[model samples]
Target chain A: MTWGIIGTWRMVHDGLVAASKMLQENKRVGDAIEECVKAVEDYPYYKSVGYGGLPNEEGILEMDAAFMDGDTFEIGGVAGIVDAKNPVSVARALSKQKFNSFRVGEGATKFARLAGFECGNMLTERARRTWELRLDEVKKNNLNPYDGHDTVGVIGLDLSGSMAVATSSSGLFMKKAGRVGDSPLSGSGFYVDSEIGGATATGLGEDLMKGCLSYEIVRLMGEGLSPQAAADKAVYGFHHKLRKRYGKAGAFSLICMNLKGEWGVATNVDFTFSVANESAAPAIYFAKMGQNDTTVIEPITEEWLAAYEKRIKQPIE
Target chain B: MTWGIIGTWRMVHDGLVAASKMLQENKRVGDAIEECVKAVEDYPYYKSVGYGGLPNEEGILEMDAAFMDGDTFEIGGVAGIVDAKNPVSVARALSKQKFNSFRVGEGATKFARLAGFECGNMLTERARRTWELRLDEVKKNNLNPYDGHDTVGVIGLDLSGSMAVATSSSGLFMKKAGRVGDSPLSGSGFYVDSEIGGATATGLGEDLMKGCLSYEIVRLMGEGLSPQAAADKAVYGFHHKLRKRYGKAGAFSLICMNLKGEWGVATNVDFTFSVANESAAPAIYFAKMGQNDTTVIEPITEEWLAAYEKRIKQPIE
Candidate 1:
């Protein structure tokens, strides 16, 4: 049986549902879902995804999130959310509160925090160290730090014929106080259909919003293109036309997991992200800079996976 | 006069020669040349153009500059400059230098200071204020401030039938420590031919270097489109295609002054830039949020211009 799911910010809620169901049945599916959730929970930048997100120029971390269940076409989304421990919960709340659609903001954070999760903090020390070094350079060069740039995205497909896609971001730091990137914009930042595959995007939000590159990639998958091919074509479409009009100032990175259980990722930047398959524990695949000779795939360990799962499933309290 | 100027960073050097000669012979032409130079010198962000450029990620404000003389196909450019008060001088130096180019890095600031100009201290109080505001926002949101994004560009063509393009920037805030943007990359960021008018670009340096959108706009001008139309098309091409593929991200604002002495500028961001014709003084322009309205063009007065020019031209000492 084939299924389909599609969305940008709503996909996280859908993933939670899928995970809940999987937990009631098989350990592997539950484990994978749990790992993903924890990945966002533990990663400092993950605040862009869940409850703790970076604020705009106004010093407010308003956030957006989405999740989708490929098999049911079920979706969840939340926009302009503040105080929500994770935008994912607002998505889930939407799924449960409204029959087919729902939206929430302002009170959502308090609601999620009340539901029992700890709020996230600033970027990790490791990430902070990395940023400080870069900041020093910026200071030396006298450049503005609020210039719009950066975001995060994720996509996954399970062997049981379920597809999921999720995106979360704090948006451009010091933006005009209320700017939103494509991270929460469906079709632009992400899309998934069990009949085809799954894809998630990152880059210049405005242009991405215009191109609908993520959904376009999934549509190409429906046309029978391999995951990689779909991603490549979608990216190509934007590069060829949009860059010309806008100037060479934006990028897109995507991951596609097809119905066949095969996965592919493509990006214009030096690095992107991916975790290992079930049995292939202890490895995570990262696209490194200047290593264009061949693909480099790393490993994730079972121990790490176990800890990650614990981190995710544990109550935020 | 339909000549195509090519090369990496030499176009600016060539442009200065044409501009200098034009300045000496025609009053209107001289005024325009002076305006172009003043634009760089006065704009606080234009450290890469005049003197007092902030260091690169490596604590070195090595600079590169170029000038394009549209009428003569003459170009001038200088690269790896340090402490040089005015890169335009190098463009002037190009006319006398045997190789038609010069590299000033170490002692470049010393050279400028020794030339009786103030050197060092590129960061202004205004820039520091902007940086602080951005840092506060970043800290509040927990974002990484050094994530690479900084460059500025200017292009103009006078009613007198002379066109000039210039770019100034501190390069990427924390790049590889020696990276350069499209600003100094001929045919990419800056391109001009009096027969077709002129163009200047800003955005992801490497991708812009590869795409050559500026020259493409000039080519479009050659194909008989208005300067504005040509610039729009070129920017559109990049926004749609190149941006997504290279994970590149930035906004490009370009202005073209045609042989008919008309000017055109286009951008994808809400607050891109400001423009002033010969009849008007330079001021900042910003687009209203969520609206596709014409940018809010502010006008500067002669008094302001005089003060600005005085401040910018005063010896750096």
Candidate 2:
């Protein structure tokens, strides 16, 4: 069976590589996606995800994560979890919990501890330095809020033909304590259907929640659009919707994959992603949507449809 | 313009009547939905929503609420909020807040306080009696854990043809503290789109979250299905998806309305709702779905589609 994995940002390149190894060892789709997201969280450069990531305004490290197994259609998630080094793992455990599908805050922390996970400080020195600097900036520049865009998510299609997705984030740097974004919540940040495929989103969780962006991408794909086409349309729709209300929109990026292994990434702002499959080694690729790009990447337009109609009438090239 | 409001349970009858009065007074769709949800939350009988509802296992009253404005395509919500008299009002304020779309836990409490909302204990004698009884039942029974359904939600259409939906719940009785259900989440418990319509859900939030039930119903309505048909299909889909794993499914109820003011309700378990429109006074309705029903509610199937097609093609008398 054709299988692959895709995620947003260059930080995930290492994660894709590690995930490829798990696949080589015949790991399950759900396990591999969790590991991939965990690997990215382990990386230090992308300070918006994993351990030692950015802290909330109260100087506490609150994190959110979600894990889904498409074959079973079972999902586990934890939000506002503190002192959990690998929140993704906690989410995985919660997915298997007999009586619950999601847990949050002290409840989440308690679940993590009861699930045999360590509950200790996750803040690192590096993150502390940045937190101090951000706190000072907040005091001086009237910048009580900030945003970061390094969420690590992974969607994998395994040899068993089962698909899975996982996402983890520390949310906006210095965000209000107990402020949850779209990450741990399904449909908005991530969605998977064994029949149609799956999608994961990154960027501003607030806008993504408004549109339920990832689920819309999968829904469009189910309606016969190609993965690339679906991502394009979903991104365009989000941008159009957000622009009308806010005058300008924040960044939004999406990665979509069908069970057949076909995949695509779309973004309102330029972003990078990593992919891995049997045909090639894990590698980084750029989806150029912002000003730096010379090419215009537009969603399916009437002109494109018209050109396709005309092509059918012409001789084979 | 045709304007209406629909909500879960007979308890919402008063709220619907109040909302209809607001619409008659030319209130905005967003405002009416918020006010209706608040009115329900203020009701003392519905022990699953708003202040003084069933407390969590920790004896804390954590409430969840979501508000979506279809005209603006904007949403705001609060989850695991404590000590706020009206979590629905907090959600409304968040929707108008310039910087954030969601808040949860202590952060949500602080935001409410800063926004001039009173924060104090909401526990009531009636709810406390139930909580104490349920806690004893939990201790004595060898029974598998049980789930309850008492969430209250409201969807409204305004004279301007805009749509809005809101949901509020204390979640499952004695649930883990900080455990969020579908209520405050956009897509799962409620979804609104001016172009299509809106949907709200009740019953098990975990299952609802897995299916993104409200959004799916709205999506089906967008795909040309009538509101009743869409709700039926959504409930059936949810059942089919859930039964495969658990061997049984939990209660799921839905209320849907199109932009034209046509509305419908469906539930796998017998449930009642209240509706109000410009054409009539507020009234209670029942949507009963169970084994005893002669006509089985089935998911989208070829036979069903064929029958639908035939019905449409029949000559009008």
lDDT for model 2, please. 0.80
**Residues A1-317 of candidate 1: C-alpha lDDT, one tens digit per residue:** 32222112222333444443443344333244434454453344333444334454435556656665555434455444555555654454443321212233323344456557456543434334434554566679977655433444555555576666666565654443323455654555666666667777766564454345666677678788887667676676556554554345355566666776556666565443543343332124444212332233344356755675575445332
Model 1 spans with C-alpha error above 4 angstroms: A1-35, A42-53, A96-142, A147-152, A288-317, B1-317
- Report, for every candidate in turn, its global Cα lDDT versus the true structure: 0.49, 0.80
Q: Which candidate has the highest lDDT of all?
A: 2
Which lDDT value does model 2 have at B50? 76
Worst 10 residues of 1 chain A by lDDT: A2-11
RMSD of each: 16.5, 10.9
In the order shown, the chain A TM-scores of the predictions are 0.69, 0.88
Q: Residue by residue across B110-226, what tens digits does model 2's lDDT show?
A: 888888987788888777777777777778995454566568888899888889998899898878777788888889999998888999999887777778889888989989999
Per residue, candidate 2 scores C-alpha lDDT tens digits across A56-167 of 8888889999998777667889888888878999998877754567887777888888879877888877788778877887799987567685678788998888898899
